[model samples]
Target: MTTIDPGAELKARIAEIKERFAIESAGGKLTVRRDDGLYRHLEVEMPKSSAYWFEVMTWPGALAITGHTGSHIFRRDEDMLLFFRTCMGPGPDWKIDTRYWAEKVQPDGIGSTGVQSYAEDRVKAYIKQAAQEAEADHPGLLAEVEEELFSRYSKADLETEAGAKAALAAFEFDGFRFDTAGWEFTEYDYWFLYTCQALAWTVAQYDARVQVAA
Candidate 1:
């Protein structure tokens, strides 16, 4: 029997997500880029269904209306778990609360693949609990959460093939940073723009030997 590599499979999964958003007919498709820190990011540019482009994108932070400018950021860092932990309080209005997941599943026997355990009943239980709690806090939050979580993420609709390639080429090489406590959407956008500007700072980190090898 042939052995399958889990790491390779994870990468493939990321690629699959990118492929899903590669359509061109509305604005553009999604793009994914790999970084040195084992971070791979997927960015999708949404289209306007309104006469006024700016008005089309206006939405309260984390609310589910049709077509909003947002990106689902995921990282392998254990620290990202804090966001999930915080969700158990007021709850993450927009996304799944993974901290409750750890609480329900108990991290001990989580399995080497990490993917397998995701299908377990405990994961579903955490999702249900989080959903119930969120719904209790604000009933609409559940519908919004479900829409973002389970809705068909059929790729952005671009006008032409060239436009699709342009969108892919536009993926900024920077990752994002945000403090849920302090930053609003505008602040988040500001930092995201600046982070794109600072992406090249990574190039300077290489030692002369490493630079030469590259």
Candidate 2:
């Protein structure tokens, strides 16, 4: 049997991410260390001027960012990228908070994510959770659902009451039915799906500015 190596995949992805961002061109530094050929740790230091400095570090499942203002730990790459993106720019809004995901660097009660978008992300997370929980209560239910949907995902949507009802409506087999009326969405940071391209433009802009100043 051939074994697929997740660490190898992650190494390639991380390398691709760095190349896509072109961090060095912006006078930023991104360094990585490997263990037994598996990409393991990462550290990032954005170009520092009198007004700004930021850093990012990651290991295994955890990622952290720090700025002059504050720092935070993040589990989701989307959250990390979006927050970091928030701090790169030309003015008050661009200042790094602590880690420089330094996003909007808003005080409590302020957020960079849009209201509807935040709600949607919450709904999606809630649904995925509900599906997993329901499956735990009814083993093999998810396998059946996956078979029906022809998707390889481990779970299904079931966050809102309406969505839960829709899930019930979608599949009914003998004694199989999804019960998710009581599932509740947990609110948290609103983050976007991350891509290196999402951050490349800002890096390019920063690099150009530094070059002109030089």
Candidate 3:
């Protein structure tokens, strides 16, 4: 079998996502939605300034105008699971930073990095447990899911040094930062914008598959 470069695959996927979903401002708000009956409709919303920053930020001054207000609605268990698996990870410790929502939901609540990490870790644990139960109940379904994931993102390539470096560079160029605690998603960051695109692409693929199966 021909080995695929994980970094190359990831770069290609990101490019494809960017092309597939052209982020446009919907007045003062930007919303991307995909409704597939087999999966929950994926709905993501952010401020127009935030979208502009992601799509057309040329200088640091542009950052001053963007707000980090955003919302993600995953209405079904399968949609959430797919998100965790594809965007976050299928690994036991993988997590999605919820700091933006956390701050909005409880501004006076514990707002330290440690607190956010702990909260995300707890959520990861629950996702992992649920995934395990799902795998047990579905027999070969887990393998199928893994296969599908691999087709899109090859693990072997990502493990290679070059691939790892490329992935890091891509994230950093998009303004992601890592500290002792973990990766941080800055306000109006490129990573979040890319994630919105990725989720939309994934939902479209799922919708296509559902149509074919039906």
Candidate with the greatest lDDT versus the true structure: 2
* Ten contiguous residues with the weakest lDDT in model 3: 56-65
TM-score for each candidate, following the candidate numbering: 0.19, 0.26, 0.21
Compose the digit string of candidate 1's lDDT tens values, residues 24-110: 113533333322332223233334333211101111121111123221222332433232334433321223222333223212243
Question: What would the C-alpha RMSD of candidate 2 be, to one decimal place?
Answer: 15.3
lDDT per residue, candidate 3, 100-197, as tens digits?
A: 32222212234332212122322223323433455555565445434432346644233333443343343221122212133221222334444445
**What do the candidate models score in CA lDDT, each in turn?**
0.29, 0.42, 0.34
Could you tell me the lDDT of residue 43 within candidate 1?
A: 33
Arranged by lDDT, best first: 2, 3, 1
Regions more than 4 Å wrong, model 3: 1-17, 20-187
lDDT, residue 48, candidate 3:
37
What does the lDDT read for residue 194 in candidate 2?
A: 23
In each prediction, how many residue pairs overlap at the backbone (N, C-alpha, C within less than 3 A)? Answer: 6, 10, 0
Question: Model 3: how far is 189 from its true place, Å?
Answer: 1.3
Candidate 2 local lDDT, 6-119, one digit each (tens): 335335544564454345336655444322221233444556454344444545444444544235454534433333445454542333232223232223346433211223
Off by over 4 Å in 2: 1-147, 151-168, 179-214
Candidate number of the best TM-score: 2
**What global local distance difference test value does model 2 have?**
0.42
- In model 2, which range of ten residues has the least summed lDDT? 187-196
